[model samples]
Target: MDILQELRYRGLIHQLTDEEGLTKKLSEEPVVLYAGFDPTADSLHIGHLLPILCLKRFQMAGHLPVALVGGGTGLIGDPSGRSTERSLNTSDVVEEWTDKLRGQLSQFLDFESTVNPARMANNYSWLGELNVITFLRDIGKNFSVNYMLAKDSVDSRLSNGISFTEFSYMILQAYDFFRMNSDINCSLQVGGSDQWGNITAGLELIGKSTGNKAFGLTMPLVIKSDGTKFGKTAGGAVWLDAEKTSPYQFYQFWINTDDNDVVTFLKYFTFLTREQIAELEEQVKLSPEKREAQRVLARVMTELVHGEDAALSAIKISEVLFSGNVETLSGREIEEAFKDVPSTELSGNEEIGLVDLLIAVKAAPSKRQARQDIESGAVSLNGIKVSDVEKVLQSSDRMEGRYIVIRRGKRNYYLAKFV
Candidate 1:
């Protein structure tokens, strides 16, 4: 399939301006395209997956993909998909967050190609220095207040009283596109459907000022079958950062996908070919109880984000904890597996007994509850059953002289840190 055809087949194309023209251009030659991410947080959550993956597809197709960091526009939050005005982050904090997001984004897209290599850009370098007077005379003249208010982003927030800072965000973002079109000959912009207004604004602004007809395309906002937003767990956004969400937790998220959702997610998240995904879908129909599709989706996605070794460790750790095979795992593997679970620090110098540690870590409600858990064999340490109510802790039992992994039943996990 051609580029647009392939994207459409995967259900990646939500909206496109002049699909035929853009498709012809894409098929003819390598087109420079871009997608922007606002540095609202230190690490991107799983919600940012589509655009980044789309960027990878473009790069793999032998086109230049520019990953634009919204260092300037982030100062004014995009009000398109929100109910309230955002609390403005300090410039210093935004700068630090932008650097963090830039680092995280780099891992997914290939940046080391000799031909049509991926490019990194920050709007701050250009938008930061453009003087107000000159900017108004040159760029602002093209965008009227009425035209700006016509945008959904500005219209939605009218009752909420959006600040001029946010109201002007579209214009500034448009300027970024105009600059890229001039400097890099970027002709296409891709973003999520929520960004349709801003993407089209950029396309319009570039065409008017530079007289170049740029194109805009967007992917659907990922939604669940129940109409909930994607990338959410009861715990919160499914983050890419290991610290925010454990690798084990991440693995389990996809593993437990609703069988109906698994088929679609594989196409959306994985690099699996259509034939391969088709096979998985048929496999799912043959044995829905087997959970084969979820297993594949979970493994491939985990490997993409955390690496092969980490994926293996996550699965092994899950088996040890869930299958009641704790005795099969070493203390080191247990610690590595539970690093991101909720944790507490115990008094290191003091000789803290098992019951005290359980209560201290809040694994059990109280001393009495801790003893019952141990007696019933509902508690395990380093994958070994701890039936003794008064077992003494030892340094050798602690991995790397700092922590112990505690499992309460199949799912609850905690870390006892002795600092």
Candidate 2:
């Protein structure tokens, strides 16, 4: 199937300009396509996954994928989806973020491909050197004030405020396309639905400045069935950086996908065949309790973003936690599993009674309650029921020589770390 048809089947195509022209261009030759990522944060979150994966999809289909890092335009934020203007970051901060973005992007594309290696470009290479005169006369002249104000990005911001710096972002982005076309022979730009205006502006500039045909495509913004935004949890945005969001948490984010949304996400994110997705859809309908679809989604997404080892670890952690088999976890796995669970630190590895340890970790309300819970078999130490109020916990009870897991009832868990 053609790349466009594949994306259409996956529900990835949101807005496309000159579909026939782009279809012909892609079919005729290995058309070079580019997508830009602004360094707004040091890490790209799950929200950025669609476009990054889109670039990979094109590359796998024998097209040259150019990942553009917007070090230049990031200095002046794009007013596409925001109601308020962005606070400008220092040049040092933007440069630092740009480097991080570049590194994260590199992991997604096969730059070492002998057939068609991916290319990485930064707009700062050209935009930083542009002078006010050249920017205004050469690029800014192409855009009319009336036409600019009519854009959704500008019109939405006009009520409260919109700075010239951000208003002129469309021109800078258009120049990026013009430059990419002139230098790298890039013919297409892809971005999120909110970037429709800027993308079309780039196409217009390329048409007028170079008198060449260029194409723009946008992907739909992800939304959850619950009507809340996707990629956001109670903690915050699910970051692609493992350090910011651990592999386990990232895996859990997909594992807990709403029943109404899982099948669609499988189609959108994974490279699963239509037949495979249809099978999963059938599973969803027949046995929603099995959650096979959610599990597959979590595994595929975790492996794609964090690598096989991390994904395996995440799966192991999830399984252990689900089965309440805390004792089976390794030291590192225990830490990853209980990272967010309520925890207390022990100053030293001291032998203490189970009830005393429970009191120390606040797993129980008090020593009296701890003893009562222990006697009632309502408390467990490291996945083993502790019924003896006098049962003592020794150093041998510690998993990994440092950590112990305590449970109050079936659900409440506490982590005790010995120094």
Candidate 3:
């Protein structure tokens, strides 16, 4: 199937400037397309994956894809999706985050393709060096105040009061599209649905300035069936950076996908063929208890972002934790699997009685309860059931010589650290 047809089938297209014209252009030749990501944070979260993957989709179709980091606009902050004004970061911080975003984008796109390698561009290169006088006289003149204010991005922020810096963001973004079009002959811009206004402004700039035709397309905002944001968990935003959110955590996030949303998420996130997805959909209908679709989504996403080794490790951790055989997991896997569980740290390496260890880790409330729980076979140390109340846990008993996994019951887990 054609790229646009596939995207449509997957429900990726939200708003298109001219579907007929863009389809014709795409069919005739490889169209150069670009997507902009602002360095709002040091790492891109799961929310940013859709656009990054969209760029990859275009590249896989033999088209040139440019991943644009919004180093310039990031400094000013886009008022597209905010209820209030954004806190501005220093130029140095923005630059640092910009480099990090470029690195992350590099992972998803093919930079070494001999035929149509992906390209990276930072708007700061052009936007940073732009002369204010020239910008006002040349680029600023193309956007009238009325036109800028009418845009959804600017209009939505009128009541809350957007700063001149952010108010001028539309023009700045328009200038970005114009510059890329002039430099690389980029003819298409794709972004989330929220970027539709800013995108059209760029098309306007390109049309009026160079009189060249450029198209705009946007993907729908990802939302959950439960009326909550898609990429959020109880902990906070699901970050793509492993340091912020571990591979295990990332995998679990997708693994917990709602049955109602699993098929939709698979379509949005994975490159699995339509038939493969259809089979998974059939499983979802026949046996919701199996959660096969959720597993596939988790595996595909975890492997895509964190690599196969991390994905496999996460899967093993999940299996071991489920089977109550976490002793097979490494120290790192143990930490990741129970990272969210209650934990306690005891200073120095010393042999602590099993009853005391349970109390220290707060797995048991009192000494009597600890002993009763242990004697009743309700306690386990590192996955082995411990019925001996006098069992002493020493340095040798620690997982990786540091951690002691304590399980009070079937699912309740706690961690004790010897420092």
Candidate 4:
């Protein structure tokens, strides 16, 4: 299938300018397309998956893809989706985030290929050197106040208020396309649905400046069936950076996909063929209890973002926790698995009885409840059911010589650390 057909099947095409013309252009020769990512944070989150994967899709179709880091535009945040104006970050901070984002973008596209290799560009390279007089005369003259005011991005922020710095973001992004066209002969720009206005603005700039037709395409903004935004949990956004969100947590996020959303997400996130997805869909309908679709989705996403090794480790940790076999988990796996569980620290190799440890870890309300839990076989230490309330836990019992995993009933877990 052609790139457009593939994108349409995946539901990745939300808005497109000149669909026929773009199809013709892409068919003629390898067209160079670009997408911009603003450094709003030090790391891109799961929300960025669609666009980055879109770039990969284009590259796989023998087209040259340019990943544009919005170093210049990031200094003035895009007002596309925000109700209020954004606070500007320091230049140093934005620069640092830009570098990090660039690195993350690199992982998805092949820059080492001999043919149609991916390219990277920073708007700051040109935008920073642009003088105010030239910007106003050459670029700013193309956008009239009325035209800029009518855009959804600018119109939505009119009541809440938007600064001149942010108001001029469209012009900066337009300049990015214009510059890319001039330098690399880029003819297409892709982004999220929220960026439709900015993408079209860049197309206009290219047409008016160089008398060339540039195309724009946007992917739909991900939304869940529950009406909540995608990639968000109680803690916060699921980040691509392992430091911000661990591989295990990231895998679990996908594994817990809602039944109504799993099939749709598989198309959007995974590179699996249509046949493969159809089989998974059939599995979902036949046996929803198995959660086969959710598991496949989680494995594909985890391996794509993190490496295969990390994905395997995440799966192992998940299985160990699910089976209540914490004793087999390594120290690092224990930490990753129980990072958010109730935990306490003990000094040195201080030994304690099972009942006292449960009380200290607050797994039980009091010593009486603790002993009752231990006596009834409702409490376990390192996966072993402790019926004896007097069972002593020492340094030797610590997993990896640091952690003691305590389980109450079937699922409640607590951790104690020996420091």
Candidate 5:
């Protein structure tokens, strides 16, 4: 498929300026495109995946992708789509976050390739050196307060009050785009729909200063069928970082997608062709009993983010845990499978007793609750139902000599480490 057609088929194209013109322009030679990521948090959540994925797509099509890290802009948080004034993060905090964000982004874009390899740039490099006077005289003159206020970022904040720091964010982002456009010959910027105003400002800067044109494209914010935000589950933001959000939890998050929302998500997130997605949708509609679509969504994302091995292990752990067939699973598999789930690594301490293990892991609310669960056949240790009121802790029972996977019925695996 052509670039435009593939983007359309994968449901990656949101809003692009002059699609045909841009497509025609891109067809001739390799071009440069950019997407900026704000280090607002320590980890990049699924919300950050769209732009990163777009960068991958662009690079795959023989274009260079500049993944811009917002070390500078992050200090003055972008007010776009925010309901209230943001609590500005400390410079040190943001810098720390920026480094981690760069690492997470590295997992998405191919930076080691000899051809069209992705490049990482930080806006802080240029933005830090600019004097206030030069900034105002050079780039700031092009954007008026009236014009900035007219934009949506400033519009929604007219009542809540927009700070000068926040107001200047557009200029900073524009400068980043300008720097990329000038230094790297990067002419395309991609972001979420909310970034239209800031992205347009960058285009205006290019037109005014260099008399060049740039393009902006965005992907729709992932949202649920109920109009609620996506990438959130009972445990919280479905982070790509396993430490923040476990693989088991992440897999379950996708597997539990509402019947109505799975198809839309498959279109938005997965690289499946139109026919493949259509088939999944058809299965959901015709055979609602079989959840083929949700399963595919879970597997595709799991494999993309984690890897085939991780996804398989997560699936195995999930099947064993959910299927209530613990006998088939080894102790090592239990720990590997529940790595992302809530776990407490115990040391090989012969002094630690089973009662302390259950309470320490919070599998039981109290000693009495622990006794109750053990007696009710609901508690099992290493796949064996344990009813011994005074089961002694043994170094040998410790799976892998330091841990044991305890389960409460068909689900909820808790790990206890003997220290």
Candidate 6:
């Protein structure tokens, strides 16, 4: 299938400007397209993946992709999707975050491809040097106050009192598209659905300035069927940085996808073909209990972000915990597996009685209850039934000599960490 067909098949097209024109442009040559990612935080999260992957899709189809890091605009936050104003960051902080985003983006695009190698650009290089007179006269002259005010990004914020800094964000972004079109012959710009106004502004600027025909495409913002925001866990946003959200946690996030949303997410997030996704959709219809679709989504997404080894390890940890075989997990895996579980820290590696250990970890309310639970085989330590009330937990009982996995009943889990 063609690139457009593939994207259409995946339901990725949200808004496309001059589609017929773009189709002709794409067919004649490998059109250069660009997407901008502003570094609002130290790391990119799952929210950024759709466009990142879109850029990858374009690249794979023999087009050149430019991943633009909005170092310039990061300093001036876009008001497109915000009800409130953004706190401006210092140049040093924005630069630091910009570098981090640049590196993260590098992971997705193939810069080494001999035919159509991906390119990276930081808008700060140009925007920083742009003089006020040049910006106002040369670029800003093309936009009318009425036209700018009419944009959804600006209109929505009028009630909330949008700041001038943010109001001018559209122009800055337009300048970016114009700059890319001028320098690199970039004809297409893609972003989330919220960016339509800003994107069209860029197209307008390009048309007025260089008389060049530029295109804009936006992907639908990912949201769950339950009406909650996507890419969010109870902890916070699911970050691309493993340090922020571990591979296991990332895997679990997708693994827990609602049955109603899995197939759509599979279409949105993965490169899995229509037939493969169709098969998974059928599996979901036949055996929702198996969660085969969710597992595949988690595995593919985790491997894409974290790597094959981490994905496999996360899968193993999930399986081990699900099957009540916690003894097989390594210390790291155990920590990841029980990251959100209640934990008690032991000061040192001291041999403690099973009842006392259970009480200390709060797995049991008291010695009497602890013993009752242990004797009833309702408590297990490290995946083994510890029915002996007199059993003592020593260094031998610890997994990796540092931690013990305590399970009380079928579902409750606690972690005992020996400091």
Residues 202-318, model 4: lDDT tens digits = 888888888988899999989999999999998899999998999999999999999999999999999999999999999999999999999999999999999999899999999
TM-score of model 6 relative to the true fold?
Answer: 0.97
Instruction: Provide TM-scores for the models.
Output: 0.91, 0.97, 0.98, 0.98, 0.89, 0.97
Error of 3 at 345 (Å): 2.2
Residues 154-265, model 6: lDDT tens digits:
9999997998899999999999999999999999999999999999999999998888899999999888999999988789999999889999999999999999999999
Q: Name the 10 consecutive residues with the lowest summed lDDT in model 6.
A: 347-356
How much lDDT does candidate 1 score?
0.86
Clashing pairs in 3: none
The parts of candidate 6 lying over 4 Å away from their true place are none
Give the range where candidate 4 is weakest over 10 consecutive residues by summed lDDT.
347-356
Q: For each candidate, what is the lDDT? A: 0.86, 0.92, 0.92, 0.92, 0.84, 0.93
Better of 4 and 5 by TM-score: 4
Preferred candidate (TM-score higher): 1 or 6 = 6
Off by over 4 Å in 1: 327-336, 339-342, 349-357, 363-373, 388-393, 396-404, 407-414
Residue 147 local lDDT, model 3:
91
* lDDT (C-alpha) at residue 396 in model 1: 73
Q: For model 2, what is the error of residue 396's alpha carbon versus the real structure, in angstroms, after optimal superposition?
A: 1.8
lDDT of 5 by residue, 9-111 (tens): 7767778887877888799878899999989999999888888988888888888998999998988899999868889899999999999999988988899
lDDT of 3 by residue, 268-359 (tens): 99999999999999999999999999999999999999999999999999998888887788888887888899989897558899988888
**CA lDDT of 16 in candidate 1?**
94
